[model samples]
Target chain A: MKITPKDVAHVALLSRLEIPEDQVEKVTGQLNAILEYAEMLNKVNTDGVEPTAHVIPLSNVMREDEVEVSLARELALANAPEQDNGYFKVPKIVEG
Target chain B: MDYSVVIGLEVHAELKTKSKIFCGCSTQFGSDQNTNVCPVCLGLPGVLPVVNKRVVEFAIRAGLALNCEILPFSKFDRKNYYYPDLPKNYQTSQYDLPICVNGYLDIEVNGETKRIGITRIHMEEDAGKLVHSGNITNSNYALVDYNRTGVPLIEIVSEPDIRSAEEAKAYLEALKSILEYIDVSDCKMQEGSLRCDANVSLRENEQAPFGTRTELKNLNSFRAVQKGLEYEIVRQAEVLDEGGKIIQETRSWDETKGITLSLRNKEQAHDYRYFPEPDLVPLQVSAEWVEEIRQSLPELPNARKQRLMEAYGLSSYDAGVITASQAMANYFDVVVGHGADAKAAANWLMGEVSKVLNASNISITEFAVTPENLASMLELMQKGTISSKIAKTVFEEMVASGKDPATIVKEKGLQQISNEGEIVAIVEAVLAANPQSVADFKAGKDRALGFLVGQIMKQTKGRANPELVNKLLKERIN
Candidate 1:
């Protein structure tokens, strides 16, 4: 399917990207070309093969219910843009 | 035109585990802010998540309790989203292949059983909470507490088979009880251990298919679930009656306002873009393990109710009430363990214990009186050390002061006055003072006999031995 500029913008918004209006067209073309190239692979016939989720053939990776020491409070908030009373602060979360 | 309400509930219950699902952070609630955070739960770069073994076991037990078919293999997927409370931009959840599928629960409505089909039960991680800085309408931002991040949650999705709000409420109740029976989740709605989101729609008749549906959120309690669904059903019916097209949207239940407000339209729906998580490997549950978990399953609510009825000779209603909560059921068994009669144990649990717990607004788990104390208090009544009336006083003292029944009876001087001479003197005094009731008793009025008996008991402050008072009064009157 051919991708549209509006679809690209919607995806960008969902991804929290602030793309400028002038770059929308250029980015849309690049994305659509990538999509077109990927769509070509869909033509190959592989109906009998099972879809794979991971590259390695591993399964059931689990751990026992043991707790380890956590990061120090200072280090945890080192990269955060803002912090208050040992918490992550963010803009209003409007969505339900 | 008459419309039938069709509802499907999505219940999210936080599993009871010592640590978070994907991290080693403590899963305890109401902790200091951010104290439970670790690199894995905080979504720091280059950190990998390992599945908690208990989470998987709890999910399987839940599936078995709900009578679901556990898939031999299941995988976790990343549900991409943008929310402040989610430390990670994407949540690890089950996508196309959930852990359990095609389960059904039977709920009772008007003494008739209605089966609600469960589409799937999947495992996922919960997000943290955001305490808004100001009024919601004008808040600049919010503070995020990551304590709940990575907490294991199982989302049980139900089919849209519910015909009314009452049925929806019943389905939720049954689901909560089953989870509580297995001791997987605390199922405390206030603490957000058990939460529900409902999808509701209306149709003109059974012949007509389900109309456009709207999803509702922010239902924190069972009352909210029922009331929210009720409001949505009526709101949809009114729109249909007015010839307005029903729009697919997500609505927020304004509990204070008692109306649902449109949160987002269909166009604004997020494309969650779910795909299998590459970091975590797929889960392959073997038949042996599933069988082992099944064998270890505790007796569920319905079975326990049936057993109570058979073992205690209690009516179905009484058994059902006593076993509604797991803690209460365990308490009932403990009370019986003290050698109290099973029927009496059930009665105390259903009547006096239930009433006190409700009035105190505390759960049976937090009750001050132990089963031994309660059983001993019942035994006090049995041994005639205290009349049932005075036993109530001792019961209150035991509950309030956490004292022993016998000690409370002794300290308060509330023992039954069974000594024949003392009761005879009290009865004679009552008969002399109430000459009217004495004459009425002589005239063969049984009601007056009861009145005179009541007067004697009142004179003894409800501590009089009732049988002795009756005998002494009868002999004197003759």
Candidate 2:
């Protein structure tokens, strides 16, 4: 129900974000304020209402399983910061 | 310090769809890297993912086959995680409301039918492939292939009902065959179409509360599944005996080392913050649609197994082996349809046919010998046209040349020598040459009769009608 500096740090770690140590308090306060502001919706006592995931009032928006033309390899990797032999290369992930 | 091993398998099968789950990209394997990439699959900005209709149908078909309850109202959710294989930080999967729930599959282990409860069957998109520079432990960098990203996958989660490695294997085999029978997934583990993970733990006894479990990964084969779990059980038992707690973690099966190594501990485990996927709307399955899908379902493995037992009068074991593969079962049916004796056909299929298939590492569909040809060969042996021994030689030639049984018999001069005159002369010559054996037979050495029969068969190149040879040899000796 409340955001703490430790919680903020954990969230940052999970999101792969590095927050400056001096700004942890500031970020924590900002997250709490956002949660408090959104918490106003809890004041409404409509307990019988069903939870809503989307507001579009639609279901089963789908497409047929058919192959369409795909992007060329050159175009697909055009924006890659680093690539090798038709692949997107990244830093070593040994933690898996 | 007795403990019970508890195992639950989570199997992921890539659905056989023409395109990726959300995008119109080909799902063909072994394509040039990145050729199947699209904006949606690559997680490019400003792109929306639409559900693939066939994926939902396949999920329902699997659910029905596994005896799961198909929820009319189901939706997808985003499971937040970070990995290089995932283009998006989170995987789009079903968390709370999976499409199918509370199913059960019956697996036979050691001649006893045990029902493994299915926890849920959810539809999800697969991650991309990561080709490491070396092994995961020492890889400097990894290359990513987005071709498999956004491919449709159904994750079937099982309860901790499996008590042994053999039971776990039976469960996996049953699951794979069902998926293959539904024509939903190809279920080829070598190609990564079918993958399995296990949650294993050891409790003091069956009545004890569940203990913390470790999740096993990288079990790429059925043998690995069984062997890995066996090793894990021993490892856990050792830990408990030493008063060391079993640390709940993810372990990678080091197949080369024949042991499981810890990849990460519980402290590093991902806290997947799953929330509803808003981009894709909820799926509303109608009763009519579910029924239609159910009606369209092919005869599953269990049903086919039962029918094989009843119709062909096969034993439970034989029926189980034959119906394990749909293609193999269909081949059996065609062989029977061609007027092959059911029991004889079952023996040949389970014996010689399966022997050749396993030795050549080919499937029944890829086998060169046709069911009609196999039936003809069986007929040759059954009708006394060729002895069973000669039939085997004929079968070997048919397999080598893909020729008809009759032609192989004719070309190789392998036909049974049923002619009485021909066999009588050969029997007489065998008697004359082996006069000691003849004397032994007349002096009541029954074993000598077998030796004389062997010589006669040898002289006739194993083409002598064994029954006729026995009768004629007995008449002449007496």
Candidate 3:
């Protein structure tokens, strides 16, 4: 499918990314070119092969339910832009 | 015009595991903020998540208990969303290949059993909790605690088979009981260990296609589930009656206002682009393991209810009330095992024990009276050491002091007065004091006999054996 400016804007919105209006066409074309380059796989006829979920042949990678040490509260919030009372504080997300 | 209300429920129960699903962080509730955060749970850079083995086993146990087909292969998927609760910007959930499918749970409403089809039960990670500065609408900002992040949760989705609010409640209650029976979830709504959401719509008739439905959230309790659906049915019916088209949207149950307010349109929020999670490997369950879990499953509520009816000779209603919680049913068994008669134990549990529990707002586990104490108390009444009325007083004292029944009965001098001669003297004194009542008794006022019995009971502090008092009073006044 061809990438449209509207599709680019929607993806940017969902990803919380701000795209300049002038660069919309450039981004759209760049996305379409990438998709075109990756579209060559569609021409190969391998319909009988089962879809692969992962490249590795691993399954059941798990650990026992045991509690190890967790990071200290100060260290956990060290990288946060804003914090209050040992919590990560963010802007209000009002539901419509 | 009456419309047929269609409802379906999605229940999310946090698994009772020691650690978070993908990390070794403690999943203990009510801990200090962010103290349970690990790099994996906090979605830090270059960290991989490993599944908790116990979480898988719990999911399998839940699936078998609900009579679901355990899929041999299952995998986690990334449901991409931009919610603040999810630190990863996506929730790790099962999109298509859930662990369980095609299961059904039977719920009884009005003494008729209705089977609600379980569409699927999938494993997922829970989001962190958000503490708003104020209400959601007016909050300047919100605080986030990642303690609940990465906790294992299983989402059981039901088919659109529920028809009314009562049936919906029955369905949720049954699910909770089964979950509790298998020891998977605590099912505590107050702590948010258990939660439910509903999809509700109204159609013109049974055969009519389902109208556009509204998804409801914040149904934190079983009562909220029922009340929200009931309110939604009325609201939808009104909309349809006014010739206004039903809008597909997500609504929040405003418990304080007792009304549902629209949250957001469905179309605007429906874009969750799900893709298979690559970091976690697909799960391959073996038949032997599933069998082991099935065999280890405890007797579920329905089976326990039936056994209670047969083994204890209890009525269906009594069995139902007793088996509603695994703890209650186990408590009943312990009481009976301690030499209390089965039927009598059932009665006391349903009557006085339940009354105390309700008034104290505590569970049977938290009750002051132990099973041995309760059984011995019942034995005292059965042996005529205490009258039934006196038993209640003894029970009250036992609850207050947490002492044995025999000690309480002896300490308060509340033993039944069964001696015929002693009863006769009290009876004669009562008759002489109330000569008019005696004259009335001779004149055939049966009520006078009752009044005499009351006087005798009062004189003896309600410890008189009622049967002996009745026989002795009759012979004296004859």
DockQ of each: 0.65, 0.77, 0.78
RMSD score of candidate 3 (Å): 1.7
| Candidate 1 lDDT tens digits, B241-337 | 8999889899889889999988877555568899989889989999999999999999998899889888879887788778889899999999888
Interface RMSD of 1: 2.1
- What is the C-alpha lDDT profile of model 2 across B1-478, one tens digit per residue? 7799899999999999999999999999999999999999998888999999999999999999999999999999999888889988889999988999999999999999999999999999999999988788788889999999999999999999999988999999999999988899999999999999999999999999988899999998999999999999999999999999988899999999999999887565568888998789999999999999999988889999999999979999999999999999999999999999999999999999999999999999999999999999999999998999888888898899999999988888888989999999998888889989988878888999999999888888999999999999999988
Question: What is the C-alpha lDDT profile of model 3 across B1-78, one tens digit per residue?
Answer: 899989999999999999999999999999999999988999998999999999999999999999899999999999
Ranking by TM-score: 2, 3, 1
For candidate 3, give the lDDT. Answer: 0.93
Q: Model 2 captures what fraction of native contacts?
A: 0.86
lDDT of 2 at B473: 93
lDDT of 3 by residue, A14-85 (tens): 788999999999999999999999999999998889677677999999999999999999999999889999
Task: Please give the lDDT score at residue B343 for candidate 1.
Answer: 83
Clashing pairs in 1: none
- True lDDT of residue B48, candidate 1: 95
Q: How close is every model to the real structure, measured as TM-score? A: 0.92, 0.97, 0.96
Native-to-model Cα distance after best TM-score fit, residue B281 in candidate 2, in Å: 0.9
* Top-scoring candidate (DockQ): 3
DockQ of 2: 0.77
Q: Looking at candidate 3, what is the lDDT of residue B284?
A: 97
